[model samples]
Target chain A: MLLAKIRGTLVSTQKVETLDGLTFFICEQLDIDGKPLGKYVVAADSVGAGVGEVVLYVTGSCGRYTDTTTNRPCDATIIAIVDMLDVDGKTVYNKTDDA
Target chain B: MLLAKIRGTLVSTQKVETLDGLTFFICEQLDIDGKPLGKYVVAADSVGAGVGEVVLYVTGSCGRYTDTTTNRPCDATIIAIVDMLDVDGKTVYNKTDDA
Candidate 1:
């Protein structure tokens, strides 16, 4: 799992039937320093996460472990809503800090 | 799926049983221009790709579609050994060019 911030949503009316009922989120990967790593992924949203929220996403076959991604073609999925980030015992990010 | 080049291998003695019999390859993601994208992933090799070979890898649930990755914890898997890469009708990468 990696840290990412939900950037936006992807809406597609025309897609494979297996992809139906899946919500996609455009996620910007974040480095340990909380900066964008200049990489982005469109991940299926397994959790009801909102835009701008920090999340943890799983990739590959493990992504299918979520109820929403089972047997789907999804390669990425937001699996968790992050509340805080701690690095080397130091708090780097805390959701409460956000107004 | 994404484009990547196998860089090295990873051996682990301690891991989940599902990961057993899985050969892990360290791969560097590539951009459309065939340049390294500064991202790396440890992918399970579904295809017989070797180090220095450019290959296509699948992630997420699709990564599990392969016989070797089914119901496993893998998130990335090399799905194809690329023979050529055509970008906008031009071959930017060809395995033959490596020789």
Candidate 2:
């Protein structure tokens, strides 16, 4: 799992049949310090993360373990909305701070 | 899965027990044009690729789906050795040419 920030939503009608009804988000990878890494991924939204919210995402086949993405060709999926991030015992990011 | 060039081998004796007996390779990711993408991954070798060989590597949980990597904590695995790579109707890479 890695940290990312939701940038926006994606709606594609002509996608693999199994992906229908699942929302997708445009995510920018974030470093531990909560800064964007400039790399991006389009990921299926399993946790309903809003734009600018930090999320924990799983890539590759692990993305399919979620019930909504099971057996799908989905390569990335937002698995959790991060509430706080602590690195080296120091608080780096707290969802409440952004709220 | 993506294309990568084997750069070297990796041997870690103190790793997750499930990863024992699996050969690992250091790989550099390649673009469709066969140029290095500047990203690297340490992947378990499933196909016995030698250094400098172009191979197909799968990342994430899919890496654990292979017989050699099943139930392991591997995040990457080389699945196939590329014999040739063609892009835009042009031959981009050929193993024989390198040999």
Best candidate, DockQ: 1
Would you give me the overall lDDT of model 2?
Answer: 0.74
Over the stretch A45-89, how does candidate 2's per-residue lDDT look in tens digits? 766568888876667776776666778887887766766655434
In candidate 1, stretches whose alpha carbon ends up further than 4 angstroms from where it belongs are A1-99
* CA shift of A27, model 1, Å: 19
What TM-score, computed on C-alpha atoms, does each candidate reach? Answer: 0.54, 0.53
**Residues A1-99, candidate 1, lDDT per residue (tens digit)?**
456889999999999999999989999998654689979999898778789987767786686666667789887877666566554345667777853
The CA lDDT at B99 in model 2 is 90
Error of 2 at A18 (Å): 0.9
Evaluated at residue A52, the lDDT of candidate 2 is 86
For TM-score, the strongest prediction is 1
lDDT of 2 by residue, B1-99 (tens): 899887655433322334458776657789998888966566778877787789998888787788887755456788999999888899999999989
Q: Please report, in order, the local distance difference test score of every candidate based on alpha carbons.
A: 0.76, 0.74
Model 1 lDDT, full chain set: 0.76
Q: Give the alpha carbon lDDT tens digit for every residue of B2-28 in model 1.
A: 998876655443334456687766677
